[model samples]
Every structure is written in C-alpha cells, then in structure tokens.
Target: MKSRFTPLLAGLVLAVSSLTVQADEVQVAVAANFTAPMQKIAAEFEKDTGHKALLVFGATGKLYAQIKNGAPFQVFLAADDKTPAKLETEGDTVSGSRFTYAIGTLVLWSAKPGFVDDQGEVLKKGAFKHLAIANPKTAPYGAAAVATLTQLGLLDAIQPKLVTGENISQAYQFVVTENAELGFIALSQVMADGQMTGGSAWVVPSNLHDPIRQDAAILAKGRNQPAARALVEYLKGDKAAAIIKSYGYAL
Candidate 1:
C-alpha cells in the first residue's frame, strides 16, 4: 500500500511541476477604450492557456511614450493601427508580430437616459453646456471624436463647450460624475452584450471618421517571452473575438 501511494504522490508532484513551469506572466499595455473587453479576454486567456496577463490601461499615445521609455510592458494593444506600425518601423516591436485585433466604435454618451438621440443630432442642437472628450493629441478616440464633429460641421460650434480629459477613461468619468453633460467615448465603455449598460448613447457612424483599427503587437521587451507570444495568438481566437464583439467592437 505504501509503495502504491508513493508512485501516485510522485505523479501528482510531477503534474503540478509541469503546470507551474507552463504558467507565465505577461505585462500588457492596453488602450483605455479597450478596458472592459480586455479584462474579459485576459480572464479567458488565463483560464485557457494558464498564462497570466497583467494589464495596464492608458491612452495610446501615452502608452507608446512609456513603451519608448522602456516600460516593462511586453504586449501593447494600441487604439489605432498607426502607433503599432510606427513602433514596428522603429524596431520597438517584434517583426511580423503586429495585427489588428479590433475596430473601435466611438459614441456620444450621456449618463442621463434619453439625453442623446440615436442619430447624434445633439451636437448640432447644442443644448448642453459642456461636452467631454479625451485629449485629441493623446487619444485616438478623441481624434475620432474630433473627426466626427468635423464631419458633422459642428466642430467650430461645439469648440467653446468642450471639456477635455487626459484620456478616454477620464472623459467617461466626466460624464459619469456629471461634470460634463455628455462625452465622446468608446462604445465598449457604455455597452455590454450588445446593449447599453446605462444612460443614452449615439453610436457614431463609421463613415464620419477614419476607421479606428486597433492593433496589438509584442514589444521588443517581450520578444523572448512565451506568455507574450501566447497572448498575441489568444487575441485572435474565437473566445476573445466574441468578447470584443460583445463590447460593440468590430473584429
């Protein structure tokens, strides 16, 4: 009986050892707009692959700056394709590791229900005193907001009422806190399971602005990290794609 138990114990120990050796951690820098979906994806990724994703969220430009300054992030999920392409050109990312993970949708959101119309005529109506947007210089969603307003011929008219946040998260906060009447933000921020989680929102038409092709890549710092490589591949999987779509992002 003792000998039989000894072999079982040895097998269990070896299995546990194998699991420990297989698990790895990756530090990921993610765009602010992708916060909700990325969280879900990270959880699924860990469950499926036994690889942990340690995520940091920020504006794309700021994250790019941090990456350039040697931040420990091994993976980057940028708000736009351009930033990752620039990094690739600059040799900051692993060659051939970059891919577009999602296409983002911008929304005009108000914490108050029925405050924004489905057609997004609120900008032209100009009844609100303050409208929030992320700093266009550092956030692609903000840039898209600007583009939308421009396309609608409301930029000059709405400029005076603009309240800017450092990033999309902050812009969303401004609306949530009632500091601004409404804001331009990522659809993912206000959506879950193909419905608005709360408040009123106008899904900005895709043709109003440049397509927000969000991309991801393994950074040079993660070139040798298995977890980083795994994460890049995981984002392309059906589970991750479903989560992204559930957040109102296009795959």
Candidate 2:
C-alpha cells in the first residue's frame, strides 16, 4: 500500500509545484470609469491564466501621478490616450507598450426615473439644485462632461450648482445617494448587460465631446514581467472585449 500511494503523492507534489511556479501577482492601477468591466476581466484572467490581478482604482490623472512617483503598480489602464503617451514620452512606461483598449461613453443620469430626458433638456431648464461631476482636472469623463456643457453654453449657468467628486465613481455615488440630483457619469457605471439598470439617462452623443479613447500601458516597473505582459494581452482578447462591450463601452 505504501508503494502504491507513493506515486500518487509524488504526482500531487509536482502539480502543486507547477501551479506555484506559474502563478504571478500583478499589481494594476485602473481608471474608475472602467471599474466594473475590469473586475470581470480580472476574474476571468485569473481563472484562465492562474495569474492574479491586484487592482487599485482611482482617477486616471491621480493614478498617473502615482505611477510617476514610483508607485508599485505594474500596469495602468488610463481613461484617455494622452496620459499614457505622456508617460511613454517621460520614460515612465515601456516603449511601444501602449495601445487603445476601449472607447468610453458618457451619460447624463439621475437616480430617479424620468428625471433626465433623452435630449438632456434638463440642463437647459436648470431645475436641479445640485449637479455632480468628477473633477475635470483628474477625470477624463469629467472633462468630457465639461466639454459637453461648454458646447451647449451651459457651463456658466451650471457652475454654481456643481458638486465635484474626486473620481467618476464617487460622482455616480453622489447621485445614487441623493447627495446630488443628477450627474454626468460614465455609462458603464450605470449599465449592465448593455442596458441601463435603474434610472433615467441620456446617452450623450459622441459629437458633444472628444472621443474618450482609453489606453493601456505597461509601466517601467513591469517592463520584463511575464504576468504584466499577459494581462495586457488578455485585455485585448475576445472575452475581455465582450465583457467591456456588455457594460456599454465601445471596443
């Protein structure tokens, strides 16, 4: 019996050893607008590759600053293309390591049903007491919102009622919690399965602002990391693209 069990034990030890050798923990900094889809992608990546993505979420600008200052993040998924290109120019990211991952969609949303119309005429009326927006300086989605307001000539009218959040996620939260009557937020935040879950929203037209061409980059710290390289590849795969599309992001 001992001899028969010895081979089984040896096989088990080799299997465990192989798993330990292949498993890698990749540190990632992600933009808040991409949170939900990324969470799904991370789970799928870990399951399929046996590599873990330890994620930290924030405004893209803040995350970029952190990466610049030697934060331990091995990868960055920015909400805009310019920041990653800037990092590459500054030698903070691997050369030829950046690529467009997804194009984001912005929405004018309200927690209450029927409060926001399809054409976004509520802004013209200025009936709401507070309007929540992410800080434009730190959030690409917020910058788009500002651009839309500027195009409509509503920026000056809405300035006083604005309630700014540090990031898009927090701006969405403010509307959900009734801290603000409505908000300009990423469509992904309030969407699931390609439909809006609960609330009234106007899917802002693409012409209203610059295209939010989100980009991903391998940081200098991850220049030679196998896991970091794998994660970037996985994000561009069909599975991840489908997941991102389900949340209303354009591929």
- With a 3 Å backbone cut-off (N, CA, C), the pairs that clash in candidate 2 are none
Note the residue pairs that clash in candidate 1. Answer: none
Candidate 1: tens digits of C-alpha lDDT, residues 46-165: 999999999999999999999999899999999999999999999999999999999999999999999999998888889999999999999999999999999988999999999999
What's the TM-score of every candidate structure?
A: 0.97, 0.97
TM-score of 2: 0.97
